[model samples]
Target: MSPTTTFQDLQAAFPHWTIWRSSADRLWATRNQRLTDAQLSHGLSHTIDADDADQLVAQLRNQEKLATGLLPQ
Candidate 1:
């Protein structure tokens, strides 16, 4: 069975894929709309870029700040 996946896991898995921290529990997959299959594949190998990763982290932080909320997204 696939191991239980967390956003962190997904971030690690797809270095090349543009992952948005959709929720603390889930990952959002995005690719530049113009990217072709080959390009997407190439990108997916890298994982989230610094800016995106930071953004995701920030989102998570914000959620954390909203003490009433605990889950991601």
Candidate 2:
């Protein structure tokens, strides 16, 4: 299992996005519901052994870059 990313770390890394901790004690990041599928698919919304929030955010940013041709896949 990977290390857990604190809500504070994710908030600091992504202040523009909405960061929250669920009653289940999971940290979550939401950007107008855009990353919902990807977050869930990657288990970012869950508390158990979730991928590092910073890494997850980086992945999302990289995906955006790739989609926009700003970065090569």
lDDT of each: 0.42, 0.48
For every candidate, C-alpha RMSD to the true structure in Å: 13.7, 7.6
User: Taking the tens digit of each residue's C-alpha lDDT, what string does model 2 give over 1-73?
Assistant: 1366566666576554566656765445554334346445544332222245555666555534433532122
At residue 51, candidate 2 shows an lDDT of 45
User: How high is each candidate's TM-score?
Assistant: 0.29, 0.36
Q: Number of clashing pairs, model 2? A: 0
Q: What RMSD does model 1 have?
A: 13.7
- What is the TM-score of candidate 1? 0.29
Q: Give candidate 2 regions above 4 Å deviation.
A: 1-6, 32-73
lDDT measured at residue 72 in model 1 versus the true structure, 0 to 100: 24
